[model samples]
Target chain A: MNPMQRVMTAMGQAEPDRVPLFILATMHGARDLGLSIKDYYSRAEHVVEGQLRLREKYRSDCLNPAFYAAVEVEAFGGETIFIEDGPPNAGAPVLRQDADIDRVKVPRLEDCPGLQRGLEAIRQLKAQVGDDIPILGSVISPFSLPIMQMGFEHYLDFLYGQPERFDRLMAVNQAFCVTWANAQLEAGATAIGYADPLASTTLLPRAFYLKTGHRVALDTLPRIRGSVAIHLGSGRGLSLADDFAATGTVAVGVSAQEDLGHWKLAAGKRFALLGNLNGVEMRRWSAEDAEREVKRAIAKAGQGGGFILADNHGEIPWQVPDEVLLAIRDAVERWGHYPLDWKE
Target chain B: MLRGGADVDELSSDLRCALESLERSQVEKVLEAAIRIHSPLEVIEGLIMPALEAVGEDWTAGKVALSQVYMSGRICEDLVGRLLPAVAQERGSFPRCAIAVLCDYHLLGKRIVLSVLRASGFNVLDYGRMEAPALVARVLADQVDILLISVLMLPAALKVREVRAGLDALGSRTRIAVGGAPFLFDPELWREVGADAMGRSAADGEAIVRRWAGEGAP
Candidate 1:
């Protein structure tokens, strides 16, 4: 089957040729190409080249356009503090006061420089490998974007002290995400990868996630044309699987700690589960150990169908060897066929 | 002694009321009640921290959201604002410690530590969020006894090395301490960042700070 057909079939909860391996490329991809992290982030050509090399190496199904998590906030007029070796961080929130919510506006896709740059990268990926791989555009969830604009304190205060204002801020932020997602879809992105890193088990309780994150996700998911993958990057809130799946997300990405069988049970048969591999472990472990762990994850989660093999989260460190990543791909190829019996 | 029992009951009741008020997001009322109580640590550990923990539990159970957690934190801060001066007046001095966020944009951990350290008698100079390594160096130059850095994100935790490198370059003597979710998830991260001590909670941080200061760990 074609890459798009395979991914879409799996996303649609049907059997594919095999379980599609969706590896979210990281700085390790660039390091494999012998490019420095600084050059990889700053230069568009370096980023594209790195991704192309990764796509060629993994022969994976998905292509993510996000290099770092701070892109959306940067586009929304927040300052981005760049470091030599790590992902750029959003500087101190621009909107410190509660009243600044009134002035907060969603950036237009073409007008916002950072979003424009991101969209351009997606467009470039489309031109280069649109047919061979499914391009998934990354967007920060609205629940997190406001925290990026206003500091976490101010944002949380707005939620509790003045819920009405909090709702307004969320509405604007969600609208901003919708606008960006729509633009990415138009730019040839086949799926929208929504990352709410802070919306994890350790950070938020299930009730708060249901009230705030769930509703915002429901609002934002429909805005995109293609499939939506909701990544609760932290492993803390596995109990919210049903809640996450109920938001109409095509797939729910779990962390290294989540049991895929448990998620399938909680989220029901409809929700496809992706991920369980530890990023730190993958970076540090031997190729043989990496293979063993990947095989274990596949055996546990790669049963009937409805699973995508990926890192627990994005941002694989540069120190992880390319051969280790290749071992993961090889293990998936050897063992990830669908409709396998548990007795094996 | 019997009369002293009644006084303890009153203080506990007052502390409970203050905490409950905080959980309800009644910032002003909680602050007022905290002032009404005589034991500041009781107000903090008994009333404030417990309230925050309750909110945290509510968040985990899906009863409350991040908004509620942040709201509870702010309300607690409001109470801290009122209590700070009173504590300063009574204690006559605060410990010499520089408290700041290490790398992540998430500041809840920093705020919690700041409050706990203040309650534990530390004169904290809070540098807020996204603090540069250079700024931390300048603060350390003031001859602070201890430096507390809180991180939440992995990408943010990487910035700790930058702070460490900066401190090394400056040849400063201030002891460095690290804590928060990142450390909980990746314990070796503390050693990687060259922190003098690592803590898992506010109480743990207090103990570690005391031990580092030669006051004996609580």
Candidate 2:
């Protein structure tokens, strides 16, 4: 089967030629092309070239056309600081006060240079790869975007202290999320990776999320034009399996802290699973350790398909060596096939 | 009802319950009642500190959320501010200590650790946010003996080595304690970054400070 076919088969809860690899090597593309992380993410052509090179080098099944999550903050008039060795971080928060919520409006996608770069990258990647590889586009969920807009501590205060203002901000952000997501779909992304780390139970109580982020997600996912994969990054989300399923997401990104087998059982074929590998440790992993982890992951969650092998955090750190990622690729090829040859 | 004669355990439980629910008024009431019964230092050590520690434990157990843990610390920081006049006198003679979010915008971890350390009467200097050079400069300027750093990402966590090397180059005797998501994700990350200690939780910050100060367990 082709790469897209393999991913589609897995999403359909059927065994494919092997488990599809969705390495979240979004930032590592810079290293692939010897471009500064800042410059590589600045232009669509650069991003596409880096992604293609990464895919060609690693032979992974997915191309992440998404840039750093901070780019979404640029829409709110926030600046981003592009580091040399890491993903760009949102600059000074845009929403500093309660009144700023009233002032912050959802900007046109074309107006935001950073977001435009991402959309164009997705379009270019789709033009280049066609339907052979799944190109995933990402948007920070409305609930999570506020973290970049108003900073984490201030955002949490706004969330807990001022309910009405928080709702208004969510309304503004929700509009941007849907618009950005649909635009990505229009740009030729096969699926939208709705990055919502705040929705994870690790960051918020299940009850609180059910009322806030869960409602926002349930409201936002369907508006997107294509399949949506909910990514929680480092956030633990196993307990929210049913909650995620309720959002109509096609897949949920699992954290390394969770048990993959238990997550599969909890998800119950509702959506494809896309992680649980500890990305932080990948930088120091030997080839044998990488192989062992890949085999263990496939053994635990690759039983009946509906699994996309990926790093749990939705990103591979910049420091991870090429050999480590190559080891993961080779290991997946060795141990990711179906028909149950691996032991528990 | 703790105004009359509430025990520390009961007060701590009430405070924890109020904090977990994000009810600042209820938390204030619990604090008021505890303060009425005991000295401010006693209330902080016996009630506020223990309650916040419980909240941290709940967060670790996934029984509570990070927002709850963060807000709980914020609320206690506010309340503890009022009690600082009384608590200040109890500050033990220890090495100069400071904490900062090193090259990371995330401050929730640093905020919680600062609150925990202050509540424990450590008199820690809050370095707000600083890059490695600024942090090293401040450590030297203040002659800080122990430096606690928090970072939420791998890049910032890796920057800890820069902070360590900067201090070492200056011939500073500043010991580094590192915490946050990266350190928690990789147990050896603190060592990899040349930190002297790793705090798994906010409460761990107080223990590290106490150990460095040659003090007994809290």
Best by lDDT: 2
lDDT of 2 by residue, B22-105 (tens): 898998888887777687777776777777777777777777877777777777888778755557666656688889999888
Instruction: Tell me chain A's TM-score in each of the predictions.
Output: 0.92, 0.98
Error of 1 at A326 (Å): 2.9
Pick the TM-score winner: 2
Please estimate how well model 1 matches the true structure, expressed as its whole-model Cα lDDT: 0.68
RMSD of each: 4.1, 2.3
Encode model 2's per-residue lDDT on A1-344: one tens digit a residue. 98999999999999999999987787788776788888788789998998998898888999987788888888878898887777788999999987788888888988899888888999999998899999998889999998888888888888887888878888889999999999999999999989999998888888898989999999899888889999998789888999999999999998888899999899998998998789899899999999999988898889889998999998888889999999999999888877767665
Q: TM-score, each model?
A: 0.84, 0.96
TM-score of 1: 0.84
**Model 2 DockQ vs. reference:** 0.79
Best by DockQ: 2
Error of 2 at B64 (Å): 1.8
- Give per-residue CA lDDT, model 1, range B103-135, as digits (tens): 566787787666656644456787776455655
| Model 2: residue B169 alpha-carbon error in angstroms | 2.8
Can you list the residue pairs that collide in candidate 2? none
- DockQ of all candidate complexes: 0.33, 0.79
